[model samples]
Target chain A: MARVIAREGQERRVDGIGQGDHLCLVYADDAEQRRVVTAYVRAGLSRGERVLYFADARAPREVLGWLRAEGVDPSTALTTGQLSVTTAAVGYLAFGAFDAHAVAQTLQAEVSDALSAGFTGLRVSGEMSWALRDVPGADQLGTYETAVNAVFAGQPASAICQYDARRFSAAALDDTQRRHPGTVELAPLHLNSRLRVTPSFRCGQRMLRVQGTVDHHTIAAFAATLETVLGWPGDVWVDLGELEFIDLAGLRALAQTAARLPAGRRMHLVELAPLLCQVVNLAEFDDISSLTVTARDAA
Target chain B: MTDPAGPRLPSSRRLTHQALIYGSDEEFLAATVPFCLDGVDQGDSLLVITTAGNTDLLREALRDAVNKVEFLASEEWYGTPGSALGACHRVVDQQVAVGEHRRMRVIGEPLWHGRDAVETAEWTRYESAINLAFAACPAWMICPYDTRLVPEAVIADARRTHPELAVGASTRSSPDYVDPAATTGFWERRIAPLPADGDGDAAVLDFDADLAAVRVFVARTAAALGVSPDGVGRLVFSVNEIATNALQHGGAGRLTMRLAGRRLVCDVANPSRRATDWFLGYRPPGPGQERGYGLWAVRQLCRLVEIDTSDGVTTVRLHVDLD
Candidate 1:
């Protein structure tokens, strides 16, 4: 590992995404900086990199437009080109409304395609920041790590790496180890991701503690995580206290699932950021006393 | 109104799916009454299931003909995938028994999805044997005055799945359809307020015809709203589209004059889809793309064009502000 000078006493939290000697992304200002990032992405693609990107924001236009121009229609073909780009705003409006599994299946399908394509480097932009907040799965850094290693398994040394500014709990490290062993962990990538989900376990209740932007990608993960945790034998409490944004999809998912959870299963969401809670109320998810997006800062 | 190439419609001897490509569903039913009476003369049983309560139109259109009605129930949200598959299986089983030599043809362009998918898909999804079975006899369709919304995918998939299936389109058209692109804006500008505050599956609104002319239906609608519409070239592309939804969807298709707040609104109450998409507004032949922007054009034009489709009735209110 190359040692670099630290910025005083500041400890930067980052999500990791690596494939071989290259990394997923690092903060870049313009085309020049992006070139450095693109070089690695291109190299990964050369090695058959399966890249999945959800443009959750607008800034990532240049990168996404390039991919979309390259003929990446993820909805139809089970397999897109080695790379694919999708936008949440467009997705919602395209079908004229929200369809959750349709959106989620898009990624699951992309990842599966990437594995088949044997794609190496996957570069994503847009709401990568918000993806880190509530649903820090594929759209965020967490998924990047899993995908990189899965796609580049048993490849040459230095053929894989992970870099993201979004950090989950150090405890998830244990879960990562227990679930996905042998995948080397890389240092966190430091960038300006809007929202960050710092996961942690409290009193045996698995809490997906969030801190940052709350968008469509993260929202789906929250519901998915809850569904995942329900299969386990513990009372789960999801604390979105530090979250910043919550769109319609996020609010609806939490409300719908919370409404019909079994008696054995109790979900209590605590600490919602102002904007986030309002969406929950608007979508009517908070009406369920079982689920709470209260006002408090935890992260 | 079908050619004599395939089996005649409303044939009682054949207990099978009969699909008729008619001018409209109403026209199909109108022809079906005469056709079924002929079938009755041949000594066979007939069962009619309608999703809409307007079967009275079928009765009235028949000109007082004697026809037996087993039951009339709504076939809208009727079955599931499993049930659909079950129904298809039975339909297929019966088709197989008819003869290994004769072809079985599945007919009718029915609008189907979800709970309605079973029966709809049966008429839609193509199985080789079913196609062969239906190839011998097909459904006789009637719709000289009805507007139907069917998913494009169903047709294509059926064609691809069953290349042997024969389907055709009717040349007749309806007149109630208001082209969303060119006419909506012109309505809001000159038309007045709506009256029927009564609520239900549909909302009935009225507008003045004297203030607005049908010749300016496209330009005036947009001009009245003081807004420029894109693809105004697609306005009222056909008279069939303009009329079908009016009678079939809303119940009637004619210009009405009503007063709302000193404003004379010339409203046309017709059945329109919850969506503004119509076959006529299409750009040549592209689908599910920038072509479906016609409704968006309508939404932008009308001052208060409300679409209320709750029960089964769908009434679209196009308000043209008249001071």
Candidate 2:
């Protein structure tokens, strides 16, 4: 079980990294990420671990400059084969697309290679900003992150997965953070709760647009927003296109909300993933005598 | 007319088909009670399947022998001829196993009132088909018709179905009784033939793999027929099961949907060698069973479910009441 290694104060430093430790660093800007990465890499180098950084949002030379600013000699580390900085295109996208198992296997093999080459351990940090380009299988990024927990367990390796919050949806950020055992928040701007629920009236109909996750942490906000929407005029259309994940509790909340609607108004759930559709269908939500809940794909 | 409580006379017959035509409740009792009592005296299994009104009458007449007889609810147990026959066979098999070769008596009174033309036709065919259903078994069945309530045509159909007629306690051969196979053939020939185009009010969907389209089509058709919102969903859920079963076991199939009076009916026909068994969907699925709920859900949701097999094609009819 890896614990949080970053302190909650000014000059936050990432430390205490050991074998089988997996950490995530979420940032809002490249300028703020430098301090966190520099501290993280220096901690590994001081422990004689081979450092591998897959940079995508910034060039390798620019990242080296950041390391130099942290009082580390980049030229010496580069020449001594102790550190390697490569672009995301060459490192993460070696297969031209990301597959959850393939990525995890590749990283595991790399860790084994580093251990065989006489390094005490392997330290890896990859910038996930490349996922914003809509690459095939990018939607599996969260699944890959979750898989890494088993990959690094009891292995002589530690990983810091960096994601630029500005380049990803709050849902993606929330999902990524939820999968990692530890996270170092470099910018407080993106630290807000990852749930945005808004209710409004459109053409005499009550409507709600839901984004991010609807889990235990954000169910209350969802319930409150739903109540506000139900108070408005005729019928309801809930656009769930932006909703990334929903738990059973969240689904129950929706069912209860629909049950309490005014007479003659129907609730339409539009644009749900296939798995979500199966969950909704299996529940027989529309069979509730008091409510008219219809699930359909957006026309 | 012979005395209702007259002394019993021993008889030897392979399969006894007796139809009792009665004018009043007393007459119905006189004819049916003797048949049931004779079975009890012979130490044979007796099963009485009839309406609640007649069940009470027979229970009182059976007196102390009521415990020895088994009564099944006719409304729930009798749906289509095929299903009713299936239920009768199950009861007969159980009773026969207990009685050995003593004999088995079944008094099946499938109500002939308030049924639509389609149901009436089906029951009429059932009456004829039962001869074939029990030809090889040593079962004595007495079908009672209320002369004051049942239509004249129904009585005539009964005459054609049974080999003998019973009034009071007397039995006589029926001139109208045709061979069981001939009776079965006559009724099958009278069933409404499938349309040549198969595309009038009925929309034909040849479904081999896709189940979603079946659901969508059922929903749209049910909604158009003014089925309640909950009814539409339930109908879709149930029809989805039927379509799935047809695809998996019934082989290549086509679903035909149309409005029959105030009811929405969908017929799923497949080129399978066997018909969907009657008891397939009428019972709860057992533990660890994965593939039995499809037809059972259909039975739960639809108002009427019937299966018929003819000339290598199996058709399952799903009827949802619009009112």
Candidate 3:
């Protein structure tokens, strides 16, 4: 039986990912993509899996260079056929058109080949920027992504579909995220059964995206994440769009963070649920000079 | 003897909890209108919370001076004693922060008609506890009790709760007043015990450290009992806060949950026999303050929260109306 990877609908670090897991890697920029892809390929090679990368925006040579710079020698694996770096033109669009079923079949074939060739599993990651180029039948990207899950089902194979947020529309990103079983997040600042706190820096703004519940049990981790995010220079933003619930202790943590911010810095909380908004307002959090809260737009 | 003008407020820069007992609307105005006008002249922020009819009476009587006085219906203002107190504290805090008002003069007539004996007693305790909750603040609050509308027993309790009484322009120190500090036992009086739990009718869980389980238990049980989604959320939040406090202060706790009529009552009890401050959740924590907000927020979220420290345990019962 194929071993299950990270729990479905939860976030996993690049290294925690395993065979039978299908993940979406949404990168804000090249730095983020390089970090995740490097860790992912390194982990795969170390685990004796056949690792493959279909480079789109970056040349295959550049992708190899990133691995080498990260202290991983890809030349030996390249010679042994355990590592392969190709281009989307030669792999996904080999027939001069995108086909969801064809690609899924190809993926299944790769998994079988890797298993037959004395490898433990097949680990593949593809730069999905090709879908943004208006390729014929490229609109079926979500369909292809969804179909890939079936190929990975009960098979020794895993895939990470990387989408550059800068290149993908918000709707496209959201759709892809929904289709994937799990997302690759930065090694989370905090993760437990009750709450998950992940930090990301985009465009000079540091943000912590909190999901699950934050009550007294998880408040210490949540508070520590706030402290780490607040340590970064400039204003901090917390995205509570995915947050299910936050109690008074969590609110107090936000208030304490705002109180401790240096002069001229503020904390912006956005996409709050209506109930959380009501609590924040009831607690008079708005009276805190360095704090700002924006409720999620009603559905 | 009292000044014909109206009640004379004390000059001390501290809170004064007073009662205004009146028989008619004219008498109510005779005592309140001049009090509000004088507050306006003194640059004090005035907050009048009364019945709609009385609000109209005060508005019509205050005339142009009405704008200076913020009016809120008593029904809306008195959700729970703790929440009402929290709201009043917020108003006073804001006024103090602005530095524009010399004092806060509030004409608060608590809703008395529909309350059961338990609720009336709690509200009465609230009236007395306000003295301690706002001891240092410059606020003069007069709670009016209508002779015709208020039950005689409640009016009698009002004298014990209020330090001063105003009866148609005659202001005097209430002979029956019991100082909150001197009667700390009265303030921490044991709340009525919850009825014995039915075999399987109540969902009970004992929690020592994991507040998350407490939340899940509450959300599930509340929803199972037919609480609306929003109500479930609130009950979970409130219960989690109380449970957190219990674990932190009392070491471990047990939760008993059951539905009484249309209300979902959850009791969180701990082994500690220590007396709980009656004003525990009645005051908001100041900025940068961390320890005092949990219970305050719980009180704001629940319909009514009663903290009882008797029978060798401290029980904080949270009530949420399922309807």
Candidate 4:
């Protein structure tokens, strides 16, 4: 069975990527993105799969040139119809704005074409940096990304959606990661050990008590707790009295999760540090109706 | 057409102005249209200056009512703070020259997306200068900024500069608002110098012609300090942006990284006197526009950043909390 390349040289079984496997690849910049693509494409070619690269931020020629520089003979692959590179307009933005249905149909066609040409399967990768623009249908991107997962269901094609952390907003990156099952986490893995998240049920409300440091590294732990609270029946409260530090990403995670609550359900931030509350106010997170923030000093 | 009994401004001068901080287009349109229509119906001349995207949005929302409004591009009207203040004075003076109305209504959004460091600082100064520039004028100006696009620091400054805040259906006096006179010396104190040696020895690396090598050097140093993998990634990216700016503007520079009081501090020093502004990445970029996102990206990734220039040397210090 063929496998998909995960990182610089790591490969996972085909089951890990096929049958409608959609991967959210988050990169920092052009250099980082190029490194990931080189690995992905080389792995696909070695697996006898037809590869398709959609150029959004860069031109097709530049992508081809980069691929060539990475030791992948894109020209020979193109001549043999084993590799194809096109613009985002052709693949993703078929109708001037990205239509999920159109993109899925195009992917279906590419997959069929690849199989008919004697290739075992298809691998498609697209740069999502274009979505950051004021395109007509850009607001529907979250829906489109979610729909793509279902659109490619049961297909042999393995698709990867690439987002540059530098280009896209932190909110967009967070939303994108949640929409896909498999994610390349941009948050640093080795977190500060002082971080502590204790989830408890108090008076029929889901409460999460966070302590020590809460930055990008440990935001996932808080987010997981929030996910559970968001699904609950009543109100949720996050106690931050013991939190010595919390970065912007951590605060955003709380705000985003609070904003996701169902109507009439609220997320109350109880006992927030004075300085942390000020940062939230500065960022206007306090303006969110679903979230009622009360500073510890005020109380 | 001015009603004797209508929503009155707090100022004794009958001037009503505020900053419209909105997250999306819908919020922007909802808050702006009602305000503009209220002015237009009152028979006041409305001046709307912003980016092309916002101009189109306002026009579409106002539809036939746009004819009564004078819309100017932000770059043309007030590209720089000094120039913008002069233009503002000219607009107020010209309106005062008309004598057709006692009060002129205006909406100025001079700072939006894609501003360099100097432009952001000057524009922020201009925002503060507005209170003085039109201190006694009967002109009421409301500035609209997209929260999704603008930086939080700029938005915070907007609150401090503008005396009022406008939301969906109501406008209220801003509690965070400080007198513009009190904030006059803001630019001078924007960045303060850090101490030479705080706790630990700093790792300094001079970079030129090799960003990748610099990334490796920072990575090794940051890893030794036990920085998180994600923090390391952002540090590398921040250093890259700072280094790129240094190389482009000042030929070559040195980057110093050290842990200070639970914060990883990295300073990029160069031989340029041009100081970067506080609003480097305040606004998010629209698609198809790729440049000018470098420093802004750095601001987004790091916890806090301070840029200073003194004696022909410019330094940008990026902090990432390790605790």
- Say which candidate scores most in lDDT: 3
Quality of model 3 by C-alpha lDDT: 0.82
Residue B272, model 4: lDDT of 84
Best by TM-score: 3
Candidate 1: Cα lDDT at A284 = 33
lDDT of 1 by residue, B161-212 (tens): 3322212322222222222233343111221124443112222223222112
Q: Report the error of model 2 at residue A259, Å.
A: 46
Rank ordering of all candidates by TM-score, starting from the highest: 3, 2, 4, 1
Give the total clashing residue pairs for model 3. 0
Candidate 1, which CAPRI tier?
incorrect
Question: Candidate 3 residues A173-287, lDDT tens each?
Answer: 7688779888887657788888988875332244677889887678888888787756666677777888777878898788779878999898888787777787887778878
Q: In model 2, where do residues sit more than 4 Å from their true spots?
A: A1-299, B1-14, B79-82, B97-101, B189-216, B219-254, B267-318
TM-score of chain B of 1: 0.30
lDDT of 1 by residue, A203-288 (tens): 22344555554443354455564454445343446666545544344555565556557665656666654434533443334546
| Per-residue C-alpha lDDT of model 2 across residues B182-274, encoded as one tens digit per residue | 424454432344453233477778876655566677778778777877677667666655665666676558888777766777788888776
lDDT digits (tens) for residues A193-216 of candidate 4: 757665433222345667676543
Task: Give chain B TM-scores in order.
Answer: 0.30, 0.67, 0.90, 0.54
Q: For residue B147, what is the lDDT in candidate 4?
A: 80
Q: Could you give candidate 3's per-residue lDDT for residues B118-227 as a string of tens digits?
A: 67877887887786678778888889999998999988989998989876655789999886656446667776555643224779899888777788899999898889
Q: Tell me the deviation in Å of residue B80 in model 2.
A: 4.4
